[model samples]
Target: MTPLLDVRELVVRYGDFTAVDRVSFPVGAGETLALNGPSGCGKSSTALAVLQLRRPDAGEVLFEGRELTTLTERELRPIRPRMQPVFQDPYGSLSPRHRIRDAVAEPLKVQGRWNDTDGPTRVAELLDRVGLDPSYGDRHPHELSGGQCQRAGIARALASEPRLLVLDEPVSALDPSVRAGVLNLLADLQDDLGLGYLFICHDRAVVRHFADRAIEMREGRVTSG
Candidate 1:
């Protein structure tokens, strides 16, 4: 069966520096593939390249069967909705001005569901789906705790009905005590939504807990998995 995301000998460079070198991996449907390594090991670079946020110097970042590397912005727009990211800082990811509900609803609106009669209901459902109370939808990012903010970020990412989530240091910013809940929430999400994850992190312990399989990187190359 075709994998949901396939990274084939991907090479990403920054002038004199090679951020990612011929890295290859496959994330099957509903699986968590952890990219584990120390800082500057190219794990994050690989994730960004897959999202087409960074253009790779060589190789392919294939989604399902589509070659994303060469897709124009116009060509990539439709596919973008199927892949979403949750970054390191939940507070930085959310807008201070927008309420949680508005933030979650933005994706749906952009996807042309703006006029749908069930828009509000759908937003509420996503909030609940991410383990946030529907009432929290009225709150701003500032009013929520780190865990709650992260949950809201997850809710926003799911608003697009993405099949894969590029979770880059998802639980790192939260308190250690709350980390388990957030991680458990992610596990539950994968089971319920059948979501594939490109889980990037520096901590091997967290990766062991969250990911089904992992690959190690060093100096922009895959060292082991």
Candidate 2:
């Protein structure tokens, strides 16, 4: 069977600097493929390239059988919703000015799936699905704890009904006490949705506990798996 996401000889460069080089990997449905490495190891760059947020300098990003690198922005728009990102720094990922409800609702609106009648309900459901109380939607990012903010971000990602999630150090900033809760929530979501995860994390312990398989990187190249 085909994988949900496949990256072949991916390379990302900036002027004289190369951030990711000749990296290849595949994430299968319901599997968590962790990109494990320290800072400046090209994990985040790979994630961005896979999402096409920053197109790779060379190589192919195949998502559900489509090559994303060759697609124009217009052609990529519809495909974007099926693969979402959950970034590190929970608070930084969300806009402080917007209520959580509006943040979650924006994806629906952008995807042309929003209706005044069911939109609010859907947002509430997403919040609840991620372990947030629906009423918490009225609050802004500043009103939430790190863990709660991350949950809110996950809710926003879920709003897109994504099949794959590129999780970039998702719990690194959270308090240790709450990290397990958030990780457990993610595992539950993956189990329930059969979602493929490109989980980028520097913590080996976390990666061992959370990821089904891990690929280690150093300086932009895949060192081992």
Candidate 3:
């Protein structure tokens, strides 16, 4: 069966510097794949390339059997909802001025699916889904703890009902105690929602606990483990 997401010979370059060098991988439905490596090993670049946040100089990114590289930004817009990202820095990813409801609903709004009446209700549901109370929706990122902010980010990512979620060091910044809770939340979300995850991190222990399979990267190339 074809994988839900496929990356073949992905090479990302910034001028003369090669960030990701011909790395290839596949992620199937409901499967969690971890990309592990030290800093500047292209793990984040690989994720960005898949999300099309960073255009690859060379390679093929296929999502649900369609080649994303060939699609124009306008064409890729609809597919964006099917793929979402949760960045490492929860504090930076969220807007300090916007309330949790607005932050969570931003994706839907950008997709032009926001409703004046139902948007808040849906936002509340998502906040609840991510382990935050509906009342937290009134709070801004600054008012929440690190874990809560990350939960908000996760809620925002899920707002689109994405089939595949790319989590770039989703729990790396949190305290050890808080990390497990967030990790458990992710696992529960995956099992309950059947969401596929591309969990990127350098921490082997976290990756082993969170991912079904782990791929190691070194110097922009996928290392054989």
Candidate 4:
């Protein structure tokens, strides 16, 4: 079978600076592909390019055989829910004003799902899926611990039933004490939901424990893993 997500010869630049050079990889169902690199190695750029949130200077971002790089934002709208992101800073990514349920429900609302009979039910299920109590939906970001906030973020991402998750340092911001729990939750989610993951991180230890396969980058190019 074709890979669920493929980045072939991907290149990105900032004016004269080339941030990602000919990077390529594939992520299959329920598998983890870790893109490991130090700061400024373009790992984040590659992740965003795959999602078409960042434009690539040249390359192919193939999601289930569709060429994403050529799609306009309007054209890419439907594809967005299929590939969601969980960023490093959970608190910053979420709206301080919105309660947890609303945050998770927003994606469904964006897709015109608010009127669906099971919209509320789905939100509850997603919160449960991410290991958060469904009752916590009433809480705001400040009311939750960092781990709880990240779990809520993941719940929000999963609200769309995403098949591939672009986790950009997903566990990096949480307390080290809680990192293992969050990573374990991600692992469980992959198994339970059959989700593919493109994990961008700088930690080798994390990769060793979390990823099914790994690639390393340095100075804007794939080095080794």
Candidate 5:
């Protein structure tokens, strides 16, 4: 089967500083590939490069067999829906001023698909899908707990019906008890939605519980161990 996403010898650098060095991996359809490493080991950098949020000094990123490195931002617009990301910090990612409904619907609105009548209903459905109460749509991000806020972020990521979701330390910010709940929720979502996940995390326990395959990184490179 063809891989859903492929990274070949990906190298990301900031002037003289190298953040990601020659990392390569493939995430097959419906599989979770975990990048396990300590902080600043280039896991997040690799993900950002794949999403074209950061330009790589060298190497290639292919989504569905097309090279993303060669594509302009305008050319990448349509493909953006295929590679949605759920960030590490729910609070940092969300706009404190926007209601949950607006936060979840922002992607759709940006894509120019929002209709006044159906937007709220769709937003509610997404919130509910991620285990948030539909009624919480009226609440702002600050009002929700960390886990609930993360759930809301997940809902927003899924709003685009993405095939591959880059989950960057998704459960790290939650309390220990809340961590398992969110991790299980992610596993369930992957199983039910047939979504591929590139799970970037430092916790081996979480990776062991949720990932299909694990890749360990050190000093900006994939390690043999």
Candidate 6:
């Protein structure tokens, strides 16, 4: 079967320094593919390149069979909603000034899908889907616990109705006690939605248990799998 996401010969650079060099991987639908490595091992760099947030200097990022690297920013706008990101810092991922509901609703509004009649209901459903109470939507990021904030972030990502999620150390910032819950939530989401995940993580134990398959990276190179 064709992979949901395919990256081949990927390279990312910062001035004279190369962060990711000639890396490649494929993530299938409803599968979790972990980029496992230590800090500065280029896992995050690969995520950015795949999202086209930082365009790759070399290689191909094929998402649903379309090449993303060659697309202009405007051309990528519509596609962006279909592949969302959930970052490590939950509180930081959300706007401190905005209520949780607003943050979750922003994606739909931006995509021109919001209708006053049902938009509020959709946001509530997303929050509930991520295991957050709809009432929590009235609160700001700072008002919620770390795990709650992260759930809110997931709700925001789901609002985009993404097919693939680029999770950049998504559970690393939360307390260990809360990590499993978030991981389990992600697993359930994948099972229910058939979503693909590019899970970037440093903890081998977590990757081993969470990922369907994993690629090990070191100093910008794929060292093992």
- Candidate 3: where are CA atoms >4 Å away? none
What's the C-alpha lDDT at position 26 in model 4? Answer: 89
- Candidate 5, residue 22: how far the Cα is off, in Å: 0.7
After superposition, the stretches of candidate 2 with alpha carbons farther than 4 Å from their true spots are none
- For candidate 3, what is the TM-score? 0.98
Write the residue-wise lDDT of candidate 5 on 76-151 in tens digits: 9999988999998999999999998988999999999899999888999999899999999999999999999999
Please give the TM-score that candidate 1 achieves against the real structure: 0.98
- Report the lDDT tens digits of candidate 4 across residue range 15-87: 9999999998889989999999899999999998898888999999999889999998899999999999999
TM-scores, one per candidate: 0.98, 0.99, 0.98, 0.97, 0.98, 0.99
lDDT (Cα) of model 5: 0.93
- What are the lDDT figures for the candidates, one per model? 0.94, 0.96, 0.94, 0.93, 0.93, 0.96
- Of the two candidates 2 and 4, the one with more favorable lDDT, higher being better, is 2
Ranking by lDDT: 2, 6, 3, 1, 4, 5
Expressed as tens digits, the lDDT of each residue in 85-186 for candidate 1 is: 999999999999999999999999888977668999998999998888899999999999999999999999999989999999999898998889999999
Q: RMSDs, each prediction? A: 0.9, 0.6, 0.9, 1.0, 0.9, 0.6
Where does candidate 5 stray beyond 4 Å?
Answer: none
Lowest-scoring 10 consecutive residues by lDDT in candidate 4? 112-121
lDDT score for residue 225 of model 3: 42
Q: Residues 102-192, candidate 3, lDDT per residue (tens digit)?
A: 9999998998889999888899999999999999999989999999999999999999999999999999999999999999999999999
Error of 5 at 201 (Å): 0.4
